[model samples]
Target chain A: MNRRPVFLITMLCFGFAFFYIPILSMIVYSFNESRLATVWGGFSTKWYVSLFSNRQVIAALILSLKIALISATVATILGTMAGIALARFRKFRGRVLFSGLVTAPLIMPEVITGISSLMFFILLADWIGWPGQRGFTTVTLAHITFSMVFVTTVVQSRMVQADQAIEEAAMDLGSRPWQVLFDVTLPVIFPAIMSGWLLAFTISLDDVVITAFTTGPGATTLPLLIWSKVKLGVTPDVNALATLMVLVVGLGVVLAGILMSRADRRRDADARLAYQANE
Target chain B: MSKAYKTGWFDRKGWSDIIIGLPYVWLVALFLLPFLIVVAMSVATKTPTAPPFSFGGDYPLLNWEGYERVFSDGLYLRAFLTSVVNAAAAMLLCLIVGYPMALGLVRVAPAWRNILLMLVILPFWTSFLLRVYAWMGLMGKNSWFNKLLTDWWNFVVPVDWAVNSIPMMHTNFAVVLVMVYTYLPFMILPLYASLERLDTTLDEAALDLGSRPHQVFFDITLPQSVPGIIAGGMLVFIPAAGELVIPTLVGNSASPMIGRVISDEFNQARDWPMASAVAVALLVLMVVPTMLYSHFQAKSGGAK
Candidate 1:
């Protein structure tokens, strides 16, 4: 066990280097004045400037944000509901079916999901005359399908750990079911819901394969935009854009972790107080 | 109110449950119904005259032609094989690279654990497409990596390393590398979760009983961690098998994977039924292994 630390450190360093070097190279090359990705001439922020000014990149960012926000909200609501149903009412009929269908999107290949979704939408549009054409609506729908799975997993795990006694206590005290949920359950699981929403948002924002199959001609998301540009050749502008994304995502994760840890500490404090009171 | 009546499924209090159940009906309509449509479309005849490549008007049932084409075509079969090999290779690479890192993290000081875990998960937050693109810059013939290796070789070896070495870009190696890199966290996190839960006393006990470290690992640790390995393997293997983005970006057209072929069938080749057939086939292949693994795990009570 004592020898573990030295061996672990060496392995950790190797893993870190393997994962980080490629990313770090991209970041470093983003500042290079040379158009060539290999040879570095001098450092400059020209690529970042170019990236900011690129209309397509800007549009894609906006579109990606729109999709992420819309899908994350919708998926969170639905996923939370499903999670509650599964966690609270475990013996319900069709529970297995519902759970399987919901989680199937998680493991199903993206290409299959994308193509199937696209076909389904096109068929539905023809039949119902709604969601007229594949665009933001379809993209959001696809994103929600996958993102909801993550949200459900997060929410379900939290709900399982949640004490049922509190809700029962509230009900015993003459509170309505809705009131019990709102006052007792919702506040307890709110951090999990927030984490689920954030996770869903990130998944939606990062999706490319699903978006590519579902998105309309005019509605390009950031990943799709980046993919097309990358296909042509590596560009420093993309490097700049990617660097920005990496920073934003890193910050979001840190913030979420802080929020979760705070909630955990609060829960621990509440538990300790209750134990002392019982004694 | 009577207690039994109050707790009844159809009671007034259960109205909220009904409301909660409503959205899942919509989910089934959106997610499950679409898959059914794909299944139906696969069997239906594709009419060139139809606007969106009609699978016939009323009865869009099974079309053997699509299945036949996928099965009979050498190109499709080859791609399928390639996909299997590539995914397996990617899964192996992820395990080799990630297992140690995860083991290390679990053994590290508690203070540094969070930072290390965050670093492991950070790459996932970047736009997946951007991460794949970054590999292009790293693996390209004239890329920084190749240049750096060549420079290092010039310092040590007399021969030109760049010229002798096989180009990493646009090869199966590059595609697999990216796939492994992208999925390494998926492998590591689960392994770490399992490894962290492991009892150090068990290892110590084994050591006290005169077992070597390797013997202790193979006999106790590996078996205990089998569930994690299976889960991690499934997580990485399933998607990587059908991975489109990495292969499309980094892999050559000469040896496309089943995913790329399926995508091509839909987008460029205009063969929807064929794409659906391929999809179904791929699903069947994936489901078999998954089911078998679950069954074995269930029998052994190994999976939590």
Candidate 2:
């Protein structure tokens, strides 16, 4: 290798270490049998055991999972519909407005989003009888607003890559529009739907700011619980919780990647077989 | 059957379009309506000592008091300036740290690339608050690493500079350090995507002519990567300006930033009008840079 490559590699290694060391240290310290998180007081799973018995941590974890699942599923469905409309229909009157509305959450400051949603929910509750006393319902709604944008982007890109000719052919072969959609478009975009669902799930799971605004006293998510606890002081149990979360999220990501790669391989194989048949 | 196949928005035969259109309507109602409410609330005067705050009156649309107070107050102005400055510094730090990592990842072997990319994004999967707490533990005064540093330095040297210089917590430096770490991947990923798409032949051609490596980089690579830089900078800058968590967690309350000011107005002072004014000011400050970045992105044909 050239000297340039060596220099670049060294520089990059330093950068990576700067980013990774603190996080890696947190993971390591979680297993240490010390009340003070910084000290290496022998290896033990005491904190993990304590974390398991902590009611606050357990409740927050369960609530966070429920919020993530519900919001991700809802957002994925809504976003897929929006993506199909945007891709298939071109000359809508409010197209620009709709596009702006969809992307606004992606760029707007979270503080602004949080404050605005809080204000809206308060006012809505005052006027209407629905969504009484903001809590999990409001938090899930806020998450869906933002997470749907990610899902829409993913699904739209996938929809663009799909061949519309197949749908046209299905229609010509005596299939109704709904049947053609079910038989052709749905199957083709299923992978995108899965990816979109995963993206929404992760985004909702990781959200803290918006969830903070909308959550009432009894509805703390894991991140919210961690945040309030940190304000007082650090605890070893939080570290153990963080370690478990990192493991779960990391596993989900790895599994999703494996499944996506498998799908891509199958698609490639099918394409090759189709070409062979034509020859 | 062909006559019934009219695919327009108003055509009733395609009822699926109505279902598809519902999400857009929900977005507008839930997302856009609240934003409009914010705009409305910003301009409306707050009633003195009331349960239900009302914006009703003859001149409901105009409240110069909020805007005037925000501009006239030195503390608010200074906070705004500090936020802009801090965001700029954080952006510069992210570029210095992230660009090289992006370059390395793209050039590395295929087998290592996936794992390396995972490392870059791993932080993003965890709760942002936990990551901040992790940094707090690592950088605290009685932290194990800091203790080790002090002990080692005391043995080797008589000077206490190492111990004194190590900030355990509650400093501007701590806030900036964490901000850089938090946003580093955001900066790196976009630049990496751009760099990966760049043709190697362009660099070869430049070298084939009599261009030095430095010249080729500045002329060919830097210009091409401008879009990535702008995109990444906007990602870091806009949020950093309004960020309340890192500064509140690590820095002193005396450190002026827009986020702290707005938060104080809401929580500590219970002054909604002041908070709204500060929020409006922050939004106004962000608008110019956002428009400029969008224009640049359009010119470069990058994703908006």
DockQ of each: 0.60, 0.54
Clash numbers, per candidate? 3, 1
Best by DockQ: 1
CAPRI level of candidate 1: medium
For candidate 2, the chain B TM-score comes to 0.86
Q: Is the docking of candidate 2 incorrect, acceptable, medium or high quality?
A: medium
How far does residue A196 in candidate 1 sit from its true spot (Å)? Answer: 0.7
Per-residue alpha-carbon lDDT of model 1 for A1-279, expressed as tens digits? 456568768988999988888888888888989888667889999989888888888898898999999999999988888877777774667878888876788888999999999888877888898778789988998888888878888888898898777766667677776787688788888988998998999899888898999988799988888888888888888888878877888888899789878978998999999999999
Over the full model, what C-alpha lDDT does candidate 1 score relative to the true structure?
0.82
Interface RMSD against the true structure, candidate 2: 2.8
Q: List model 1 lDDT by residue over B1-304, tens digit each.
A: 5552333232245654574576587678888999998887777676674334554556534557888877899988999899999999999989888888888998888999998899998888777887788888887767758777767767787564435444788899889999988999999999998989999899999999998877887898877777778788888999999899998889978999999988998898777778888899888876557757756984685535
Please give me the DockQ of candidate 2 compared with the native complex: 0.54
TM-score of each: 0.93, 0.92
Give residue A140's lDDT in candidate 2 (0 to 100): 95
Q: What is the TM-score of chain A alone in each candidate?
A: 0.92, 0.93
